[model samples]
Target: MTPERFAECLASLRWTAIDLTSALQCQLSWIEAMEGGQAEIPEDLARWLESLAKCHEAAGIPSHYRGVAQF
Candidate 1:
């Protein structure tokens, strides 16, 4: 996914760069760079986001709020 998409997805999931860093076990700087459009969204990170979306779906946690993901 593009950096912009990654940022959007993150907003949808109600996650901050700090949260993603913890979840992905990556450096906060990495997440910051990705979200700030200084770096590309890695393939693995995109896949992980997709998996998180699926988990949210399975848990019956609404994925969006007003056309944006809220969880």
Candidate 2:
């Protein structure tokens, strides 16, 4: 996925960079690189994020707020 799409997924999940770093057990710089287009978001990782967003959607996490997703 593109860096912009990665960032959008993060926003949809209401996750900050720190939250992603903790969850992925990776360095903040690595995530920053991904978000900044210095690194590519892996295909598996991209698919996982998409699935997570789907889960959140299916569970009505964002249903109350329309396009806005809440953690």
Candidate 3:
């Protein structure tokens, strides 16, 4: 996902970059860089985000981000 998409996703989840990084047990800078597109989305990070979204959905949470179309 694009940085904007990722940022929107975080907002939808009521999570900050620090929260996401803490939740995923990653570095704050790493998460920021990834969302900023200073670094590419690694396979592990991608999978983690996918899993995070799924977990949120399973918990009956709705996505705040509409999609790439609106973006």
Could you say which candidate leads in TM-score? 2
Q: Give Cα-based local distance difference scores for all models.
A: 0.79, 0.86, 0.76
TM, every model: 0.65, 0.77, 0.60
lDDT of 2 by residue, 1-71 (tens): 89998888888788988999999999999999999999989999899888886676667553456768668
Ranking by TM-score: 2, 1, 3
Candidate 3's TM-score reads: 0.60
Per-residue lDDT tens digits of candidate 1, residues 1-71? 87877876776677888888898898999888887888888788798887776675567654555587567
| Cα RMSD, model 3 | 9.1
Q: Output the lDDT of residue 42, model 1.
A: 77
Q: List the residue pairs that clash in candidate 2.
A: none
Name the lDDT of candidate 2.
0.86
User: Candidate 1 or 2, higher lDDT?
Assistant: 2
Write down the lDDT that model 1 would get: 0.79
Alpha-carbon error at 60 in model 2, in Å? Answer: 3.6
Regions more than 4 Å wrong, model 2? 62-71
Highest lDDT: give the candidate number.
2
